[model samples]
Target: NAGVTQTPKFRILKIGQSMTLQCTQDMNHNYMYWYRQDPGMGLKLIYYSVGAGITDKGEVPNGYNVSRSTTEDFPLRLELAAPSQTSVYFCASGRQGAEAFFGQGTRLTVV
Candidate 1:
């Protein structure tokens, strides 16, 4: 089974532009999360969903949104991208506190 996948492994967006970073998993996990890892930094949670149709904001949810409409997919949306948003975005999933599997990641840069 494919653990996880993300499109456009790297991207450069002008300020105020928008984009969606897609993530999918075949593990049928119940919990999915979005986190951003800044250069030489630890991950900061952006959003999470316990199950399909239920989602909530996390530590750094500004300028970002997420939705889990199915068990296999969760995508992160960025509106009005800013330079501060330049970072590596990772999509992860697991059963609660279990070890979360991560996607290869999408590196985004806003100019």
Candidate 2:
């Protein structure tokens, strides 16, 4: 089974469009995180889920939302797309104190 998976590796959205980036892990991880990396910038945390039915906002959660209905899935939704939100998003899952398994990443461009 795959350790972690993310759909729509690349996408371009309009100024006001919306989309959900899908993430799933087969490792039954209790911690899942979403991060975005802009050009020439470091990764910024967007949202995270500790376990099933428990989710929390990260540093840059303003324009995004996440839901963790199951331990294996944590999807990120982007509302009201904007050019400033263009970046590569990564989904990661791991245990409490171990290394996380990351998805290939979704490249989003808002034009």
Candidate 3:
């Protein structure tokens, strides 16, 4: 089964455009998260969900939103994107204290 998948491996966004990064997991995990890593930096949480229909904001949620509507899907929405939003987006899933499986990542460059 696919552990975690993120679409559009790379994207270039102009200022003020919007996009959605898709994430899915087939492991039936209850915890899912969206994180962004700037060049040569650690991952910062943008949003997370404990289960379907339950989402919460994390460390960095500005200009971003999320919805978990099913057991396997957690999508991150970037609205009114800005140059500051340029980063590598990664989707992850796992139990607490467990190893989280990360997506290949979506590289977004907002110019």
Q: What is the C-alpha local distance difference test score of each model?
A: 0.93, 0.94, 0.94
Clashes of each: 0, 0, 0
- Where does candidate 3 clash, by residue pair? none
lDDT of 2: 0.94
What is the overall TM-score of model 1 with all chains considered together?
0.96
Off by over 4 Å in 1: none
For candidate 2, write residues 1-111 as lDDT tens digits.
Answer: 788999999999999999999999999899999999998988899999889999998999998999999898899999899999999999999999999889999999999
Candidate 3: tens digits of C-alpha lDDT, residues 9-110: 999999999999999999988999999999999999999999899999999998999999998999999989999999999999998678889999999999
For 48-89, candidate 1 gives per-residue lDDT tens digits of: 999999999999998998889999899999989999999999
Please give the ranking of all candidate structures by lDDT, highest first, separated by commas: 3, 2, 1
Candidate 3, residue 15: Cα displacement in angstroms equals: 0.6
Best by TM-score: 2
lDDT, model 3: 0.94
Per-residue error (Å), model 1, residue 93: 0.7
